[model samples]
Target chain A: MGIEPGRLQFSWISSAESTKFVEVVTQVTNAIRALGPNPDFTKKLAEVA
Target chain B: MLSYAEKIREIAGRLLASGAVNMVIGFRQGTIPMMNEPHFAKNPAEAAKLVWDSHCGINLANYLTDRKEKIGIVAKGCDSRNIVTHIIENKIKREQLVVIGVPCQGMVDKRKIALKCPGEITAVIETETQVTATGNGFSQSFDKKDVLQHNCSLCIHRNPVIHDELVAAPVEEQKGIDRYADVRAVEAMSPEQRWKYFEDLLSPCVRCYACRNACPLCYCPTCFVDESRPQWVGKGQDPSDVRTFHFLRAYHCAGRCTDCGSCERSCPVGINMRVFTKKLEKDCLDLFGWEAGLSLDVRPPLDVYRPSDPNDFIK
Candidate 1:
């Protein structure tokens, strides 16, 4: 319920659209990098691991 | 004005006597006022014990998992939907089942009745229009429609999508229902407020797994909670642990849950766990125009993906 909005991304691309897929992936990687790691799941991940 | 109990017994008896099925799964009257037990009838004599009423809220499809015997089962709208889910998920074979479908009105919410009459309910008499509860030196009556479980009141599917036999003609589905009112209200809150809302909502969880066990869709051989080498959730009553458990449980049932209200019904402390699952149900509907357990031909939402699917949330 407390999930921050920027921590996740969703995209739709067909298999033939390789350039579009790479562009979208690069954009998402940059956006997530700006937001940093998700604190909510990171703590739980550490506990479980 | 159909006599459901009598019809159930007749069908069950015939099935068992004719050796069409080895067992009939339905409800028997409980010792308590408003509770009923899921029962298995092996013969005509045992089939005679089967009874049906509004208190038959627990999903009978939960009992169909991994059973080898050819069975006849009494199924309400939600129960039959879960049966379809079981068939699709390989929990049970379609040929192995003889589904006796009943047109459900709704199940009475015992918690609502308790709030109405704050005494130990000694007896309950229910008709199509009213529910009368009598207890120690007190009697109370409420309109039947008012005391329905929250999910039932908003249910759109009142007739079985699949059935071998119908106990009665299908009832009219509820129209003009605002099913996502609660979900929308929660969405309107600030993230911190929403966080506190859920924290308070799940604070009473005892982690008994009744909610998990009650769900016909939840039949994993070994659940993620039970993972030992990489223990996903701590066994203690930590708030974080409780929240994590609820989150994962709801996520696991993304496109599989049929909103049968069994999880909420089985909670001893009366936790409204449907809040979690309902969000996913809404997402599935909006994104994929999908309702779980409606058909055996199509796969669940998460199982199939479309290249042209909407993805506005992406960067």
Candidate 2:
């Protein structure tokens, strides 16, 4: 439940609204790029492996 | 005005004697004060041992999981709600149960009382109005309304939603209660402050799964903590492991927890684990306008998805 908000995104777009969907995806991609990878999950994954 | 103990025994005994049910799940007097054991009455004679009081905080629905026997179970508002959850989840059948509902006032917080009176609590006596805690050298009494479990005080449903028979007329449901004040207080904090708040809050955990074991909703055949294949949670006293366990446990109960307060009650170190579950409960209510175990017909929020369901935070 402590999942960082930046790591996840949700938006509603109809099939007709392809441009809106692309815009949302681009915004999310840029935001996540700025934030970088989720260290907590990556560290946990490494420990598990 | 409710004489629950006598009524429960009478109803349970009748159910057993009539051969309507093979077992009656209820509470027996506990070995110590402020604790009651979840018990199974196999015969009319054993049904005589069934009692109800402020101490019967353990959810008896935990015993109903995968039980094949026709059961007559004593259920408070929260317990009845959990039974509905169980029925919806296919943990048990509605036809297999005869719910003996009790209109709850509230269960007392023994820890609060213990803090008020500093000694071994030898005996605790409760009435509708007050609770008296007695020890060797001291006797303290407090208003019943003042010491109820946080969940119980703000409970919207004080009457069983589904029951075959009631021990008494349904108690008035609590109205206009601010159920999420503590949650709101935490929400007001900065993200870093909140992270620190929870870390400090869970610092006392010894990784004992008493909270998980006590919850009726947590009847997973193999809990994630026990999974060895790509083990999800470490079974150590490390603070991160403890936090992970708490986080996942609360998440698992997202749409199904009835805010019964058993998890908090069962904790040895008195951690308020309800903080985690209540946040989920509030979110479900806000997002879906749903409360757990209110009806058998409706699926839990996470169990079913609609095309129109909100996804505003998603890309």
- TM-scores of the candidates are 0.90, 0.90
- Cα deviation of B126 in candidate 2 (Å)? 2.2
Kindly report which residue pairs in candidate 1 clash with one another: none
Model 2's C-alpha root-mean-square deviation from the true structure amounts to 3.5
Clashes of each: 0, 5
RMSD values for the candidates in order, in angstroms, are: 3.8, 3.5
Q: How much is the TM-score of the A chain of model 2?
A: 0.70
Candidate 2 ranges beyond 4 A from true positions: A1-3, A9-33, A36-49, B312-315
Among all candidates shown, the one with the greatest DockQ = 1
Compute the lDDT of residue B10 as modeled in candidate 1: 94
Query: Cα deviation of B125 in candidate 2 (Å)?
Result: 1.9
lDDT of each candidate versus the true structure:
0.90, 0.89
Give the Å error, residue B256, model 1.
0.9
What tens digits encode model 2's per-residue C-alpha lDDT throughout B1-315? 337899999999999999999999999989999888988999999999998888788988999999998999999999999999999999999999999999999998988899999899999887778889999999999998999888899999989999999999988998988999998888788756777788789989998899999999999999999998988878877666788899999999999999999999999999999999999999999999999999999988797877768865432
